[model samples]
Target: MFRRAFWFTAGAAAGVWATTKVNRQLKKLTPESLAAQAADKAIEAGHRLKDFALDVKSGMSQREDELNDALGLHQDPDLPANVTALPGPRRLRAIEQDQNDPTTQFSYNRNEDH
Candidate 1:
């Protein structure tokens, strides 16, 4: 009968479609495919993080420049235009001192008098 043949054809088509779908899913679940997918995602995340860091850095520098301009920090009115300020002598001496000296050792004892 024509009705029986039509049903048989439909059933066969359904079976083929299901088999193809299952096969595609199995291919995606394989170890190599899974690893590739994970690697792709990690790379995408890294690129996004890198872009965020660069944006932050640029914004910080732009804000710093704006603040400096607002505060008039670009030039000192008291100092001569030709002369630039240098670090203080006391700070330089402190930085030049030996860091390994025993007298400079830090103490954590709580009972010691000030």
Candidate 2:
């Protein structure tokens, strides 16, 4: 009789524990809970991305300063912004089309029969 009572008590406690565990798991799988978890993860990723961008910007600034020092391109108060000579589009040199000009001897005429 004592063994039967002990077994019954044990079975009731196990049932309660299993129900609580399943309920907690189900609550976590609900849509609102899932959305909240996803939002938390996205916020964490955004923070990491912002930190990475700041690090890249700092490194680029340092490299730019080093390159300027190496190339002796110190900014001068007396120099005009246009005088910095930053690379830009340039006009192509005009090709001489005259057949008689020796410099134009290699000019190809697509219409001429070989």
Candidate 3:
């Protein structure tokens, strides 16, 4: 009788253990759990990508500074020695006027081609 009782207790314990293990696995495999896991991974990847972009930007700035120092471009704060001045607003307005003039030799009209 004692042996039978012992066997019964063992079987009940095994059944409970199996049921608990299966329930835990099922919970993990649910749609909500899967979506949450995917969301977490995507957020992690986004953070890593943002960090990489910031690092690249910092490296670019450092390299640009080093190049400026090597080329003696940092001597003037108002105007760099290596860079040329761009066309001002007056030059841009003159160029626009030229482009708009139909009598000009090099005038370009978008409507003319069509």
Candidate 4:
């Protein structure tokens, strides 16, 4: 098992060394024309993406405006209706008799003598 692991590690190190050497050679041999071509492709893709985004936003906004108009959300009609009658105020009345009559005596608790 140890022998296998050692050979495997050695093989991996050799492969990495070979890859680094190849990368250095390729970096030194790079042609300016290929780099320019890649840059041009990137710019063209950017313009296409920008156009797509603008079209999507414009279509969405147009649909939103149409819906708002159909719903009449921006319009106001006539005077505002009275909302005071919605929840009627409570009236005070004696359970046994009407409190407005002066003849009715008000009840008093015996504890009030303290």
**Pairs in clash, predicted candidate 4:** none
The TM-scores, one per candidate, come to 0.65, 0.60, 0.59, 0.37
Model 3: what TM-score? 0.59
Candidate 4, residues 1-114, lDDT tens digits: the string is: 999999999999999999999998777567875687688999999999999999999999788768767876442332133211111122123413435676876443333334
lDDT (tens digit, per residue) of candidate 3 on 1-114? 999999999999999999999999999999999999999999999999999999999999899889877877554343334533344566456557876995765422334323
Candidate 2 — worst ten consecutive residues by lDDT sum?
87-96
Residue-by-residue lDDT tens digits, candidate 2, 2-101: 9999999999999999999999999999999999999999999999999999999999989988998899877655334434333222211212233345
Model 1, 50: alpha-carbon shift in Å?
A: 0.8
Descending-TM-score candidate ranking: 1, 2, 3, 4
- Compute the lDDT of residue 69 as modeled in candidate 1: 82
Residue 101 in model 1: shift from native, Å? Answer: 34
lDDT of 1 by residue, 12-110 (tens): 999999999999999999999999999999999999999999999999979977987887756456334543333255533443563445466332232
Better of 2 and 3 by lDDT: 3
- Rank candidates by lDDT, best first: 3, 1, 2, 4
Q: lDDT score, residue 27, model 4?
A: 78
Off by over 4 Å in 2: 78-114
In candidate 1, residue 78 scores what lDDT?
38
